[model samples]
Target: MNIIEVEDLTTTYNGHTAIKNISFKIEKGEYVCLIGENGSGKSTLIKTIVGINKKDSGKIIKNIPPEKISYLAQNNMIDLNFPATGKEIIMTGVQKHKCLPFYKKEDYKKFADVCKLLNIEDIINKQISDLSGGQRQRIMLARALIRKPDLLILDEPCSGLDVNITKELYNILNKLNKEDGLTIIMATHDLEEIKTIGVRVICLATTVKFDGDIKDWKGEM
Candidate 1:
């Protein structure tokens, strides 16, 4: 089943075209990667798909529920001194209504399960500001998983992490895609990590340059 279909999608900023015309389809439970150099419309395409930036033309058909699609951007700009615990930050993902006065017991249980699944239980009580860079990334991932999103959209998920941590994150993502059958669409420039994850690769150089098995990338910039 096609979870997302984009036809002739285009985006412009101040009359400058970011993505000329692009088309693609993401299947259910498929792990797809969006690759391109900087200023090559990778981020524009993602923003357009997620509705952060309005497209200039074409169509974006999302068959999945809006809430079921979670987007984790490169820079997660949350205040460092917000005074929120890691668990609380994660629970925010599961909270549907922002105005809700209290969290139910089931919500807490779900949060705990997600933490355990991401191996972030030890940092649950720690403040978000006190965690390491890799730990913070894991916490953000746990928060995304707490909502049980059907389609996960990640932009440069392993940007600042060390090689070892990047490998660990890839392992978790691969497990999530294979074991839980979650559909993942990630935009990244990490070629090595891409090879390790072994997903379908979609290279966007202002348009759909390549889309196929990652093993066949050919290293063609």
Candidate 2:
């Protein structure tokens, strides 16, 4: 099943087109790596797909509910000195309910499951200011996962981390896709980081440059 489909999509801002004639479809349980150079409309296309940016034209057909599709942006904009525990910040990702009083047993269970999945249960209690970049990233990932999303969309999720941590994050994502069958569309700069992870590659340069199995992508890196 096609979880996401974009055909001839276009997005422009201030008369400058960020992405044009973009098209692709993500399968229900497939992991897709979206690759492109800087200023290649990768972010724009991702934002458009997640309804963060308005498209100029074309079509986007999403098979899942909008609320069930979780998105992680390229940047982490949280204040380090916010004086909140990592877990508190992640709790904000849970949608508010009229009858549900803040955090319920099921909510904490979901939190525990998400934390265990990301292997961050040890650090979630630390203050945000004292956490490392990798920890913070994991918290963000946990927040995104707390909703148990059917489709996960991430844009350059590992931007500032070192090599080992990036590898760890990749391993977690790989496990999620391969084991849990979570459909994912991730935008990234380093194709080689995920090139061998059994994922389809979608290259965009303000448009569709290449779309196929990663082994079949012929572009020179």
Best candidate, lDDT: 1
Per-residue lDDT, model 1, residue 51, is 88
lDDT of each: 0.86, 0.85
Instruction: State residue 169's C-alpha deviation in candidate 2, in Å.
Output: 0.5
Given candidate 2, what's the lDDT at residue 213? Answer: 90
Model 2 clashing residue pairs (backbone): none
> In model 2, which regions exceed 4 Å deviation?
96-101
Q: Please give the lDDT score at residue 156 for candidate 1.
A: 85
Which lDDT tens digits does candidate 1 get at residues 1-221? 99999999999966788897898899999999999888888888888888889998999999988889987777455676779888888887887766675888888888878888888888989998898778888888888888899999988888877888888888898999999999999988888887876889989888888889999878576
Clashes of 1: 0
What TM-score does candidate 2 reach? 0.93
Off by over 4 Å in 1: none
Question: How far out, in Å, is residue 6 in model 2?
Answer: 0.5
